[model samples]
Target: MNAVLIALLALPLLGAALMLAPIGDRQALRLGATVTGGTLLLAVALAAGFDHGDPGRMQAVTDVSWIPALDVRLHLGTDGISLPLLVLTALLTFLCALYSVKKLPAGPGGRAFTGLLLLLETGMLATFAVLDLVLFFLAFEIVLIPMYFLVSRWGSGKKTAAANRFILYTLLGSAVMLLGFLLIGVKAGTFDMVKLADAHGAGLSHTTQLVAALAVLVGLAVKAPAWPLHSWLPDAHTAAPTVGSVLLAGVMLKMGTYGLVRVLLPVVPDGTATFAPYLGAFAAVGIVYGSLACLALARAGAKGDLKRLIAYSSVGHMGFVLLGIASLTPTGLNGALFANIAHGLITGLLFFVVGAVKDRYGTADLDTLSGATGAALYGRAPRIGALLAFAAVASLGLPGLAGFWGELLAMYGAFDPAAGLSRPAFVTYMVLAGLGTLLTAGYLLIVVKRVCMGDPKQPAPVAELPDLQAHEAVSWTPLAALTLLAGLWPALLLGLSDPAVKHLLGGG
Candidate 1:
C-alpha cells in the first residue's frame, strides 16, 4: 500500500526527470501520455484497494523521518477526503497528456512543455498525499513554477501578464500560509497533519488557532480565489493554453478548497468555527458575482470571450464548494467533496470543447465563433456544438448531470447548517446561492442557444469547419460519461466522503 502511494508520487517525478533527456516532440508527447497513463492506472488501483468500509481512516500511509532535528517526516497518506482528489488529479493529467499527443497550441511542444506538465502533476499528486505540514507546504509550492512556465511559454493572449499575476498572488498567499503552518507546528510540537487533526486544537489556545486559521485560510482562499481574491483566475484561464486551462480549472483550484476541508476544518475546528460565517458570506457573494459576470459576458455576444466567461463560472462553482466547507456539516462537507470532483470533470470537458473551438475558429470570442445570427457552431460542427452544449448544461447544474448533485447537496447543507453556525445567515447564503444557480442556468442556456441553435451567416465557410477530431473525442468521452454517471448515481462520491467528513468533524 505504501509502495502504491510512493509510486503515485514517484512515477510522475521520474517521468519528469527523464523528460530532461533530449527527446523529440513526438517522443515527448508519447512519453508524457505513457507516464500519466501509468499514474492514472495507479490512482485507479489506489481507489480499488481503498478501504471503503473504513474511509474515515487514512490508508496507504508512508511515514518516515526526513529531518530528525525538526521532527519533520516524509509522511503521506489518503482518506476519502483526499482520495477522490488524488484520482481526479491523475485522471485530468492523463487526459491532458493524451490530448497533447496530437494537439498542442502553436508553441515548442516537445520536451520542455511535457516535462513541466509532469512536474506539475507530481506536485498536485503530492499535495493530496502528504501528511506533514512542512511537506504539504512544499508540495503546495512546487506547482507554481511549472504552471507559471506553462502559461508564459505556451499560452496565447496576455500570457506573460497572466502568468505573472498568478505567480505573484499565489506566492504571497503561500508565504502567509507557511507562516501559519509553522505557527501550528511550533505550538502543537508537531507537524503531522493526522496528529494535528486528531488533537483538534487541543494543545492550542483559541487565540493561536484564530491567528493561524486566518493566515492559512487567507492563503488558501487566494488559491480558492474566493471573492476579491479571485481576480487572477479569469485572466489566467483565458490566457493559458488548452491543456493548461484544463489542468487549471480541472484540478488546481481544488487544492485550495481541499486544504480548507482537510487541514483547516480538521486541525483548527474552533478557528474555522469562528470564521465560518464570514467565509459563508464571502462565498455567497462570489456565487452571485460570478453568475452575474457570466451573465453579462453571455449577453455581450461577440464581445464576450468564451474562455474568460468560463473562468468566471469557475469562481461561482468554487464558491459553492466554499459555501459547503463553511457550513461545516457532514452533508455540506460531502457536498464540497462531491462538487470538487464534479467541477473537475465537467469544467475539464468544457475547456476541452472550448479549446477545440479555438483550434477551429482561431478565436474564442462568442460573436466570431457564433456568427451574425449567433448560431454557427452546430451548422459548422454539429458534434462539437453538442459537446459544448452538454458541458455547459452540466456546468449549470442541470438535474441529471454531475454538477447538479453537489450544488443541490450544498444548498441542503446550508439550509440547516451546523449546531454552532447561524441558521439564518446560512439560509440567506443558501437563498443567494440558489439565485446564483438560476442566473447560472440563464447564462449557460443563453450560451447554448446563441452558439448552438442558430444558423450561420456564411453557411458555406461555416459548414466547411471541421467537427470533433479523434483525439478530442478520445479526451472528452470519459469526462462526459463520468459526469452523467456521477450525476445519476451521486452516492458514488457521497458514500466515500460521508464517513470521512464525519471523522474529520470528530465523528459527529
Candidate 2:
C-alpha cells in the first residue's frame, strides 16, 4: 500500500522530469498520458483496497521521520476525505493529457507544457496525500510555480497580469498560513496533522488556537477565494488555457475547503465554532455576490465572456461549499465534500465546452456567439450546442443531476445548523442562499437560451462547422455520465464521506 501511494506521487514527477529531456511533442504527450493514466489506475486500486467499513480512519498510511529536529515527518495517508480528491486529481489530469493528444496547445514547447502539467499534478496529489502539516504546506506551495507558468505562458489575453495576480495573492496567503502552522507546531510540540487533529488543539492556549485558526482560515480563504478575496479568480480563469481552467476549477480550489474539513475543524474545533457565524455570513454574501456578478455580466451582452461568467459562477458554487462547512454538522460536511467532487465534474465539462466554443468562433462573447440577432450555436454546430446546454442545465443544479444534492443538502445544513451556532442567523443565511439559487438558475437559463437557442441572423456559412470531435467526446462523456450517476445516486460520494465526516466531528 505504501509503495502504491509513493508511486502515485512519483510517477507524475518522474514523467515531468523526463519531459524536460529532448522528447518530441508526441512523445511528451504519450508520456504524460501514460503517467497520468497510471496514476488514475493506481488510485482506483487504492480505492479498491481501501477499508470502506472503516472509512473514517486513515488507511494505507506511510509514515517516516523525515526531519526529527523539526518534528516534520514524511507522512502520507488517505481516508474518505482525501481519497476522493486524490482520485479526482488523477482523473482530471489524465483527461487533460488525453485531450492534449489530439489538440496540443499552440506553443514552441509542447513538451514543457506537458511537463509542467505533470508537475502540477504531482503537487496536487501530494497536497491531498500528505498527513504532516509541514509536508502538506510544502506540497501546497509546490503548485504555484507550475500554475503561474501555465497561465502566463499558455493562457490568452492578459495572461501575464492574471498569473502575477494569482501568484501574489496566493503567496501572501501561504506566508500567513505557514506562520499559523509553525505556531501550532511549536505550541503543540508536533506538526503531524493526524495527531494535531486528534488532539484538537487541546494543548494550545485558547488565544493561540484562535489566532492560528484565523491566520490559516484567511490563507485558505484566499485559495477558496471566498468573497472579497476572490478577485483573482475571474481574471485567472479568463486568461488560463482550457486544461488549466479545468484543473483550477476541478481540483486545486478544493484544497482550501478540504483543509477546512480535514485541518481546521478537527484541529481547532473551538476556533471553528468561534468563526462559524462569520464564515457563514461571508459565504452567504459570496453566494449572492457571485450570482449577481454573473447576472450583470450576462446582461453585458457583447462584453460578457462565457468563460469569465462560469468563473464567477464557481464563486457561488464554492459559497455553498463554505456554507456547508460552516454548518459543522456531519450532514453539512458530507454535503461540502460531495459538492467538491460534483463541482469538479460539472465545471470541468463547462470549461471544455466553452473552450470548444472559443475554438470554433474565436470568441466566447455572448453577442458574437448569438450571431447578428439569434443563437448561432445550434445552427452552427448542433452537437456542441446540445452538450453546452446539457452542461449548463447540470450546473444550474437541476434535480437528478450531480449539482442538485450539494446545494440542496447545503441549504438543509444551513437551515438547521449544528448546536452552538445561532439558528436565526443561519436561517437568515439559508433564506438568502435560497434566493441566490434562484438567481443562479436565472443566469444559467439566460446563458443557455442566448447561446444555444434561436436561429442565426445570417445564412449558415457554406463550410459546415464541426461538432463534438472524438477527443472531445472521449474527454467529456465520462464527466457527463458521472454527473447523472451521482445525481441520481448521491450515495456514491456521500456514503464515502459520511463516515469520515462523522469521525472528524467526533461522532465515532
Candidate 3:
C-alpha cells in the first residue's frame, strides 16, 4: 500500500516521458490527457483504500535511506492533512490537461509544454507526500524549474521579464528556505520530518525556536506571496498562459500554506504559539489590502483592460485563504483548507473563462466586451454567459456556494481562536475580514454587470467569436458542480478535515 504512494508520483513522470517520446504526433495531446487522468484515478484509489476512520496517523508508510550520513531517507506517505491537497493536485492537473485539448494554441514547441505540465504535476504531488525534509525540498524545487519554463516559453505579455522576475524571487526564497531546513536538520540531527515533528524541535531553546520559525516563515512567505512579499505574483499570473495560471493559483500557492501547516506548526509549536498573533495581523492586513486592490483593478477594467483585472482578483480571493490560516484554530485551519480548494476551483474557472474571452474577443477590455454584438452570447450564448456569471457569483462567496463557507469559517476561527491565541486582536481581525466580503462582492458583481448585462453593441467580428465547445464543457462542469455541491453541503469537506484538524491542534 505504501508503494501506491510512491507510484502516484512515479506514474506521472513515466506518462510524461512516454508522451514526449512521440511529441509531434497527433495523439500526443490525447496521451498527455490520458496520463494525467490516470494519475487522478490513482489518487482516487488512495482515497478509497484510505482508512478515513483514523485520519491523524500517516497511512501506508514508505521509508528507505537515501543519504545515510546526513540521515536523510526517501520517506513518503499521507495523513489526512496531505490527502486533500494531493487529491487536488491530481484533479487540477487532469482537468487542466482536458481543458487544454482544444483550448491552448499550438506554438512551434507545443508538445514540450504539455510534457512539462505533466512533469510539474508529478513534482507537486511528490512534494506533498515526501516526509523527509531533503526529499521534500528536492520535490519542491523540482517544480520551480518546469513552471519557469512553462511560463517563460509558453506565456504571454512580457514573458521574458515576468519569468526572470519570478525565477529571481523564488530562487532567493528557496535558498533561504534551504538554510532554514538545514538549521533544523543540523540542530535536530536528522531530516525525517515525522520524527522531527514528533520530537517537537528537539529541545531547542525558546529563542532558538523563535528564530527557526522566523526562518521557515520567511521562506514559505515568499511562495505564499503574503502582502509585502506578493509583488511577483501579479506579473507572473498576468503573463502566464491559462494552464499555467490555473495550476499556479490552484496548486502552487498551496505549497507555501501547506508548508506552514505541515512543517512550521508541528516542528516549532513553541514558536507558533509566540508568533501566532503576528501571523493573524498579517493575514488580516492582506485581506483588506487585497480587497482594495481588487476594486482598483475593477476601476482599471472600467477603463477597459482585461487580464490585469482578473489577475488582481486572485490576490483578494487568496487573502481569505491566508487569513483563515492565521486564525490558528480548528475552524480556521479547516476554513483555510476549504478556501484553498474553493479558490482553486472558482479562480481556476475564472481564468479559463478569461482565456476563452481573450481567444474570442481579441481583447479582454471590459467596456469593449459588451457581449451584445458578435460576442453577444446572452441571446446567442446565454449558457456561456450564464456559466460565467455563476462562477463570478460563487467567487464572490455568494450564499450556498463553495466560496462562502471558507470566509464564514475564517471569521468563525478568528472570533474564537484556540486556547493560547490572542482572542481580542483576532476578534478585530474577524470584523475586518467580514467587511472584506462586501468588497469582494462589489468587484465580482462589477465584473458581471460590466461584461454580461448589455447587448453586444460593437460586434467582436464573427471570425474572432465562437461559443464554448464540447471539450470545454467536459473540462468545466465538474469544477462548477463541485463548487455548488460543497457550498450546499459543507459537511463533505468539513467531516473529512475534522479529525486532521483535531490532530493538528493537539487534539480537539
Best by lDDT: 1
lDDT of each: 0.92, 0.90, 0.79
Candidate 2, backbone clash total = 0
Writing each residue's lDDT as its tens digit, candidate 3 over 1-508 gives 6877878898889977876475564467677788888889989899888888887788979999988988889898898878888988999899888877777654546578777888899989988899998888888798898889888888877887988888888888888888878888887778888887777665666877787788888788778767777788888887788888889988888888888888887777788778888877777777777777767766532554456666666666666666677777788888988888888888878887777776776666665665433245565466677788899999889889999998889889889887878789989988878777888888777777766665554555454445778877888788899899989998877777777776765622
lDDT (tens digit, per residue) of candidate 1 on 1-508: 8799899999999999998898798899899999999999999999999999998998998889999999999998998889989999999999999999898767776788899999999999999999999999999999999999999999999999999999999999999999999999999999999999989899999999999999999999999879989999999999999999999999899999999988899888899999999999999999999999998888844389999999999999999999999999998889988999999999999999988887777888887766667656786789998999999999999899999989988898899999999999999999999999999999999889877877655543244678888998999999999999999999888888998899989923
Q: Candidate 2's residue-wise lDDT over 1-508, tens digit each?
A: 8788999999999989998689788888888888899999999998889888888898889999999899789999999899989998999999999998888766656799899999999999999999999998999999999999999998999999999999999999999999989998999999998888888768988898899899999999999979989999999999999999999999989999998888889888888899999999999999999999999988735479999999999999999999999999887888888889999999999999999888777777887766545556787778888888888989889999999999889989998999999999999998989999999999998888888777655653224568889999999998899889999999878888998898888823
Q: RMSD for all candidates, in order, please.
A: 1.2, 1.4, 2.2
RMSD, model 3, all Cα superposed? 2.2
Off by over 4 Å in 2: 300-302, 456-463
Candidate 2 residue 17 Cα shift, in angstroms, is 0.9
> What TM-score does candidate 3 reach?
0.95
Sequence-dependent TM-score of model 2: 0.98
Candidate 1 Cα outliers beyond 4 Å, as residue runs: 457-463
